[model samples]
Target: MAVPEGEISDALQVLRRVFGYDAFREGQGEIIEHVVAGNDALVLMPTGGGKSLCYQIPALVRKGVGVVISPLIALMQDQVDALRNAGVRAGFLNSTQDLDERRVVEAQFVAGELDLLYLAPERLKVASTVQLLDRGDIALFAIDEAHCVAQWGHDFRPDYLLLSGLHERWPDVPRIALTATATQATRTEIASRLNLEQARHFVASFDRPNIQYRIEPKNEPKRQLLHLLRTEHSGDAGIVYCLSRNSVEKIAEFLTANGIEAVPYHAGLDPRTRAENQSRFLREDGLVVVATIAFGMGIDKPDVRFVAHLDLPKSVEGYYQETGRAGRDGLPSTAWLAYGLNDVVNLRKMIDTSEGDAAHRRRLSVHLDAMLALCETVECRRVQLLNYFGQDGEPCGNCDTCLTPPESWDGTIAAQKLLSAIVRLDRERRQKFGAGHVIDILTGKKNAKVIQFDHDALSVFGVGSELRDTEWRGVVRQLLAQGLLAVESNYGALVLTDTSPEVLKGARKVMLRREPEPTKAAKAAKTAKERKAPVDLPSEAMPVFERLRTWRAAQAKDQGVPAYVIFHDATLREIATAMPSSLTELGKISGVGENKLAKYGNQVLETLTPA
Candidate 1:
């Protein structure tokens, strides 16, 4: 595994000279050197963990252009812009480009003038594209977002299936596959599908400590989201995820109406509008993009301060992938989600009604079960999240549970009450009821529905009045989460599962977490924000930072590139804090590579002069 001394040195130089990083972060050195020595690797690093460097540096140190295969055509422009800003000769070929544009990039590739070439896996299906690649000298094949190759993965793309032929075609060229997150099972599947079983595997710890994970009960979710944006993340760039496209449009409108500049993105959006919205979100500051799972794959925007989810995610993998998009520049960020009883019932019903066989339905159910466990757990959210990915983590004191530890109370009687009600309705009335009707009958409500059904006539009816309506709802949700309750797919009625008998007969103990009160939850959220690891610039330097941002925005707009493509917020923060008086001093800052310093150094110095 020893990389030659010269190759290792060259990798470090490229990392310093081109990337402006003084040293490698954790396992990056090994990966970069391995790829530099023309060895295959499968890397699983956390998002914002400097993953791009593992391949980008090797491409610079090696002899030929690095070819990257990805399906995120929407982001190739930004990625190439950033690389080109860093002085790397990068070009991309995707459906978005015209024939003339493709010819220009193809000429660059054949002329050996490009250091990196980006392509969608679908483009490889075209014989002309393959022939064009064959005419160029390739240093390595880097499969970005390699997790997509997993058939059961959260973000599977069939085009990724074509990537397995890469190694077979370019046997002499080194190939490396990389993903920000992957469970061990998914890891095995990715390796199997991509023909990388023999590749050396490197997994970094799947912990994003700067991200404070928090989940709350869904109570007027739209208002809760509005409060989160107004109070904590005011004027910060962020993302809000909704489960449906309809919800996406509504949420985006709601935010915009409430004085937040927001946009909507989903599969239903026309291609031009979707592209425009994506472009605006990337290029603008303090804008929120409400979207479905369709949006965030290859986004490299570093200043996204929060990622909020209105509905429950179907699996922990999808949740992790979506939330990981925040704080890509190593800044403090928030990953917040709100869930409720209906979410559980709806997800289960969807699984049961899903278009799949028994095995496929079982797999989908398993993913949902894991997701529910994450939502209902009283333990640290980060611990549960990391555990799902087969990685271990200490209880991060930054999450909601650790901040305001919830109480786990015995709910055996409560469970029996709900289950008995369901049983009574089924046996006595020969009918089933949803959670609302069941809760009403149990709570002694003599409303029209109960009066019409005469549900109060049953012995169990009105017998369980100790718990309030919300408390009873909580019990039902937890039971469903624990598999003691099941939801019928057709009518969304509550039903008992095989395990419900254990709880009903007092043979099993049911434990449930009591959610924090409104005030307590608000205080905990505020405390988390206060206790966050600071990635802020000094107050004295704030003016300088803003000026630099203004200058950078103008440059970005003029050049038709995203602001981060010019320089990240983190880089700006570094510059302001250092208050470098000269170009030499500015070049010493991390992220100030040779090209950027050369391009923006005088302007940055001029911008700082007034401050």
Candidate 2:
């Protein structure tokens, strides 16, 4: 994607005048310039990496209204509001709107009064919607969340499959497909599915250095999550992801009971409740959202301080995307996950029972394997995460592993003992048991299930006495991850794979990552001390910052928009530090574009001034 001479000035002008950024971040200028010059593009940038600017700048600089195809209907209001706040004439037509509201936006688009018009992907299916668009000239088509085109992706949208025809219908309109998450395979599928194979592709580095990666072995996970919120991210906005709707509801209620302002979102919730909870989370400060992967796509909130996982995410792409929701403001944030053996077994069972051929199951297993490797890795979490997305990165000292590195040990004997126990149960007893029963037998615990299931007189029983229950569970988890062992499809019982023979024969040695112990507390406290502020806020400016936030909340309430639409935290940080005395001075700050300067500059000055 080359920036043609004399063409980028328009984009740079829009960047400064409309978006109020002095210059482009790493890869944005080229994408914007390429699209502005009537060329198609596919952009792959990390979340909060100025992805919107890649298309928004080109939309502002191009001739006709830029028609954007978006997937989330609930978010269109805020997205459009943010654009309108920055002085761009933006409107959206979604199912949430009444017929009258849709007509107004349609008229505006047809009249060429809107700089950008957003449509839900499903809307493109309507004959009337296509006819309405046919009546207006399109500047360019921007397909946002383009990764949804992947058939098996977690966020796949069937309506997105219709997008390939956009280029066919309007052959002259340059189309740019953009997404914050995609691997090379998903990227290729997107390009082919969207009929953009010829489009110039721009893939930005997937590293989000500001986010600290932390994956803890699951142990009283709800309590661990509470500790994380209370000690590190108290009174800060964040997202917590869970794998089930029941888990989402329970976690939300537990947090609320413990005095944290938490809300739940899931597909099972009524639409109104879901929308209200989402709006509240976005508009209010210091709120936490506990959800399945149903929430937090294209969430533009810049002040989110952490993203915690109560259960293991099934794939690295999802983990990265969900955690990428945090630290969007270029501020330090945490991506914390709590994983255990149950999570691994359950996800494998789900994939086995999942609808699809063997290929689909294999693809899913591949995703799960990568995720498991990430959780069990002794190396840097950030490095493994970046490498998963085909990017290289050094060990960032910010992640849990780099902060207090875990130890690796030859767990060959332990692994051999565990495998022997399973083998005896299968061969002699002619029965299979899940990890719990197996561990109970190995640790010689005469629990009720163990007693009911068997005579404890098995030969391999009690051989795993050298390691504690948790350590034995760790070995089982690693063996499962390493493909030497697997969960039975029907009952989730531990079963040996073909690779098990090599390990049993001592042909291959088993190495396992030893969990870092209580040193995590010291590391956490040090990290917490460093991340106390939103990011780089001086102590003297704290009062001004708090006062400004209060005023902004009031303004957002009056305007009925998310607070970020009024002024992002980054913008407010700049204002508080500068402590401008006049509207002229306030107007010069970044993110105070022309409309906002004229609209809110005086109020900002008044807020900064003494009462």
Candidate 3:
């Protein structure tokens, strides 16, 4: 159905008055226009890019309810709550709802009282739910987190595989699929799986410049994480991701012991405990959550100050999506990672032992290699990250490499020496070894295995003594990233590949980065001092900001919702800086929508006033 001119004006009015945005963000208007014009779209926008507006406005302007297929129950609840706070008639149907609650929501949907209805994809599998949908007029179908439809994605949800039935059943309803992260390959897969081949594709820039990316070698990981929190992110909310539940629990305990409020979340935890912890992390201030990858999908928290990876993720897409969770309010947050060679070995072993065909294993390898390249790259991290998403740009000065550039040296001789050692060990012994044993032989360590293999007598033995053990390991990692070396799936041994002979024969030159030494003492001191400085707000506004935060905390507690759900720290900072007096003036603030102004305007004004 073509949107009438009056409805177009109404949509614009909704954008400004209801949502409190003076104008549409880049590409939002176009996507809204297309969807309102009754066309399908596939949207690939970054986190915090205002993606919800693209369909939400159209839902309001259209004739009936908008059906949103969300993957998580918590996410659906949060969205419905936020929409209701904005004065929109919204409700969700999920397993968490009781029979009476579901009946009420179903009645509202049937009565066309809800502007939007959020449903988990599994709900659509029920015949009764499908019939309920068939009886109502659905303005559009929104498939959020569309990347879950790709079978090869790290965050694949089996329920998402059943979403294509929407297209089959409601052929005339315009559908929009949206995700924060998707490669060209994954994009094609989503399109194919969702039957959105002809949908208009809106690929926004994947750069999240507000998040400063930093990857450091994992030396004394616990101490490093503590240092990061104490020195840089004290009194801020953040996430700490680990690869396993045990690690998450341990880290959470450690942080709690060190006087930081922290909680652990993983799939292995009991459902009630998990829900309570998640609610705590969302509702409380300055609470850190140490979790596995299972915890973060569809999280709508906007003020996560940082996302630190205690272990490496599976792929660049996974890393990007996880890190994108931070700085969603467009404030300066961090994406810090502690990565090392062991992460590489463990991940490779995981791929080898995983239940998949050779092709799938190869694809996993390609994904891991890309992630490794990002870790080992001497160039700008943001550029490499955007390049992975098929965008090209100049260096981003906010990342670690751009801030303190790593020195690159022509490691042609070093590469040859390492490759020569592998060649000699393979030629004489007909065997291979992991990087530790190989590095031992190179550094003249004379370990038991090196002596047993008589590798101490090789020509390449002790040739790498000029470089430190860490430097030698860097060479090995770079070679692996360059495809000159491959880990044998069966033995986890570093073996030569087709390209190794060229490096050994001096036919190719390799330029490798010299890993910088850790500067814990000096950097920690500087960071602590920097943390003491006020962020973005003037000194005069500090009191107002603190009072605003106190009020927000009380409001959030009373309502049982996240403080950010009321208004982000960024918006509060703006309010304190601008110091608006009246309701009319408060409405001019970015996040002060009509409903919020009506609800909290007097309280906010009173908070800003003196006693």
Candidate 4:
């Protein structure tokens, strides 16, 4: 049945009044209408597309409290906090709350005083929780991060598999499962796992036009990081992702010591330290958090200026979701990556030796292939990344390729040579070699590792000498990126997959882009130029803009957040330049949402026209 036109508009009023959002973001209306009409939905919304509101508004307009199966305690807390702050009666039952607190929240939910109740997926399997849901008028059963239900998803959680039971318990309640990242294979698995086979699929475009995707060769990771900090992110909040705990520590310390206000966050840090560091980042302006993947699962910071990857993520899905965290406010942001052969070898080895069935292994190998294709393609990075998620569209000119195309080379022969090395290395004995050793054998390096192992005698050795070690590394990295090769996670072994056969037989030809030299000129240009002020601003109000920024920075520091939370620099610049004197005028600023206007809009006016 089609949604009644009047009801949809009524829902819009609720969205504005309770959530303070004057307008619905793209794709939100359709998803909301579908869920509110009592139908199952699989929503693939990009980050900051207002996916939360799709279910939140529906839950409020529906008959009963929506049961949200969520992933983390921190995320649930953030969600609940945001909802409560919006005047929505939302609460969550998670391990983090004390028993009394849980009892109070549970009572409110049971009394139907709550519009939404968040629960971890693992909690859903508990007989008591299941019984509670069966007894309540569950208007909807919503699963956020629904891709976790899939075995092939990047952040797969074992608990998510139990969510299929929600369908069995509340067979009548409409279920809406949502994820920001889901490839075709993951989409299929999510449907089966959630038992939402007949659900409507709301796969929004994954393109984030605001982010500028850039991948640079690993000339010097630390220097590159400092350069990014000094030039691109002088007073911005961003994340620097590293592979190891040690790297996170060293990088955070190095940046902090060099006068960059950075903090370290990784699994190795104590929970208190991690929380404190995260709080500092969230509540302070100009703070950088160097972390492992543990830091950003459910971060709600809207204006992360840049996301720099010191290590290549495991798959394209992982890469997209991680980078999507930046530029969430729709302003221009940068997505930078430092690529190297070590990342390739490590990722390949992990998938090749993982303890899984052949089908699972092959599935993983396919994901790696898509990731490799992404890193090597001269096409728009956003285009390829979205294409991986089944979003086929035109190239977005926001990425490096659209800005400046890279030099491409036909890597057919090089690909064949690399595959041949994998075959000769023996599939079962994968862990004993590294990319350097393999490349040595391929180019006949006469290195001790290759010579000692007699890999120098292999027929494929030296035949690929036309390429330098760096070039050969690119070939192997591209092969790994293309899913023809993988590293064994257990022993760090490089292993070739079945796809290697086709490439070696010349049935497949791969194109690879040569990594470009570091651009010192671009670095110089950015460093020398001041942050540009908006041209349209009134001349008299320039001082007001500076005062607003100073006030915003102080407010953000008090909250332990980056300045963007208080107001984006672009928004503040526009405010000062435009010189909006009233609430009406203030709301017109680019990033001034109703919540922001209500809480701080008057203060902005006061600061602008002080007595």
Encode model 3's per-residue lDDT on 1-611: one tens digit a residue.
Answer: 46556766677788988888788889888889889888999999998998889889999887899998988786677778888888899999999989999999999999999999999989978999999998898999999999999966768888898987788999999999999999999999999999999998999999887788888878789998998899788999999999999999999999999998999999999999999999998888789999999888878888898899999888999999999989788877888999877787778788889897999989898889899889989899999999999999799776778767788899999888887888888888787889988889888988888888888988878888998887787787777777887787777788888988888888888888776657633353354345434566898998999999999999888887888888888779989999998999999998788998999999999999969
RMSD of every candidate to native, in Å, equals 1.3, 1.5, 2.3, 4.3
lDDT of 4 at 395: 75
Q: Model 2, stretches more than 4 Å misplaced?
A: 1-5, 531-534
User: In terms of lDDT, which candidate is strongest?
Assistant: 1
Cα RMSD of predicted structure 4: 4.3
Show model 3 residue runs off by greater than 4 Å. Answer: 1-3, 448-455, 519-535
**Scored by CA lDDT, what does every candidate get?**
0.90, 0.89, 0.87, 0.79
Q: Which residue runs of candidate 1 sit more than 4 Å off their true CA positions?
A: none
Q: Quote model 3's TM-score.
A: 0.95
* Reference-based TM-score of each model: 0.98, 0.98, 0.95, 0.85
Better of 2 and 3 by lDDT: 2
lDDT of 2 by residue, 162-216 (tens): 9999999999999999988888899999999999999999999999988998888
Assess the local accuracy of residue 141 in candidate 1 as a C-alpha lDDT between 0 and 100: 93
Ten contiguous residues minimizing lDDT sum, candidate 1: 528-537
Positional deviation of 89 in candidate 3, in angstroms?
Answer: 1.3
Model 1 C-alpha lDDT per residue in residues 60-110, reported as the tens digit of each score: 888989999888899998899889988999999999989899999999999
